[model samples]
Target: MRGAILPADSDQAVLAGRLDLGEGPTPVLIRGGMVEDVSAAAPTVSDLLERDDPAAVRGRPLFAAAELADRGPLLAPVDLQAIKACGVTFAVSAIERVIEEAARGDMDAAAAVRGRLEARVGAGIRSVVPGTPEAASLKAALVEDGMWSQYLEVAIGPDAEVFTKTAVLASVGWGAEIGVRSDSGWNNPEPEIVLVTNSKGRIAGAALGNDVNLRDFEGRSALLLGKAKDNNASCAIGPFIRLFDDGFTMDDVRAAELDLVIEGPEGYRLDGHSSMVQISRDPEELVRQARSEHHYPDGFALFLGTLFAPVQDRDEPGRGFTHKVGDVVTISTPKLGTLVNRVTTSDRAPAWTFGIGALMRNLAERGLLDIGGGAGDGHD
Candidate 1:
């Protein structure tokens, strides 16, 4: 998994991430195939990214990057960063969300609704830009035809759908288990590119993410979004964050193509693809919307919503896709490498005991808090 998780051009890539060194979460950098503990320069990933040149920060070498998996489990490459996500940022995802609402969380009924809805509005939604006069006209027409949906409103409406996905220190990293609600009958994984931003909302780096979805809960009522989204071990991010450099820039993120593969314990396999080029809202636009009337003092990780929405029947015809326990889900892109995790019920997944308080106490105990006090400030 370690070999698979590194970028294709890792030797030239500027990477930042975190690892469990038994004492606590330690910020590290993977450069030239070596893992260097950067805690001496910056105590947390959040602090490291606050540097003008986070990739340039040096540290003590711990081990070769090849032994990453054996050294210790990789923690989410973030500390104290808020976890936020955008919804229905792709035409296909918007349509699938409408189907989810129409079916009222019933996977068996989705096929018929999907067919009818796609036939009526798919092309129109795909062509219109959000928050435009053209989008307004489309909304009017859909409402007149008695087909208007809240999901559609957010999809093409003036404001994008940005919501909090989980909390700080709640996200799991590579080779960990991702959770889905046990009772959720309709669900799937959302493969996305997560933008790591600093306190001032500056884009520091990018990483792969799995925004695990519980369609049943959210489809029943959008108000249940919190319950549907925030669950124990439901969010998975990392392997490592590729800090922006001349070698990789926002243009690379704009043209990224993500691939997802789910291997079920019962011999079921599903392959899916999502292209950033197909996204309705540009990554920058989404970030602008997120920063509106908000402040992330510890910075934030924003999930640029996915385009892939699984409609293929897994068990029975017309039943649609849903995760089963022990399914290994892999989300990958060449530049960002890969993020892999096993699926399990929220109740069954390991509890999230380490929170901000635990983190602060641990860092204090290790004398990390004073090592790099305000090291990365007034830079970039």
Candidate 2:
């Protein structure tokens, strides 16, 4: 139930519980490239948006998705090798807050705090150009609903959500679909990257950060600078939420296969269906740990303190600002019914870690991290 707005740097994405679209789900993917302002009728997902957010819609088209089919940008899934060589800007700070705080309970309160933090982070960044209408509106919206946050899912196949895990890693601002789990290891023919695989079935995360950065950057901060969202069109996410449930639960990773096809000027770029990387921690754990680390505040004063921390970096702290662009996103999962989030980033030396302990412990003391544990576990 707990999840952040892809660009955790945008608005606050409170992790709710597991929301099963009843018996079936009508899931469609809209990539960053396809993120166009297309106004499509709502799909059958019933409720995609939040009940409170009247601007919410059951289903709508994405502007990024629109750009992908029509835009031109080098978007690809990266491994730990690539991430290391490139560096990951996806700082698990703000989203981590949402996770930890909500885990304590107070979903509504968590939202308010995270929302303010995201806005603060967005506004703090120096606009490349400075002052233009788009830039100005973007700056204002950064505190409101700027360009850093936006998405829309469409229902593609009838059995769209069949056995998929939609891992929308805001770090990458995209998602992947993990189909099934594998018993053996995958000899990766692909480039260097972090392959999220399942061990037994507990779902642990295996990160192979690149040992060196090939760019002209120094440390994490320099690397983070590379993560800036430039001509980067859009990022896309999966057909459905990859879950380790029944029928689809073959335990063996080979039983699952989620695919994504990218046709650029170079012909067709095929990914997935090939278990090059193994995601140790499945999506569930990703969300679980993400939230587990967030230490909320206690009373009103403490909450206020956490909110106005800097009103600047106080919200997301370290690298969270980069999340506004999210890192490189992907669609498609592996065999184990989970989504593998392929993201990009800068070096790892920067102090991007958000002080969840400092915040959450305070919040937990007051009774956050509850939320009934995300509305989690779908019915039988």
Runs in model 1 deviating more than 4 A are 1-3, 371-380
lDDT of 2 at 115: 61
Judged by whole-model lDDT over C-alpha atoms, candidate 1 comes out at 0.91
| TM-score between candidate 1 and the true structure | 0.97
* C-alpha lDDT (0 to 100) for residue 104 of candidate 2: 36
lDDT of 1 by residue, 177-279 (tens): 8999988888899999999998888999899999999998888888899989999999999989999999999999999999999999999999999999999
List TM-scores for all candidates, in order. Answer: 0.97, 0.24
Best candidate according to TM-score: 1
Error of 1 at 117 (Å): 0.4
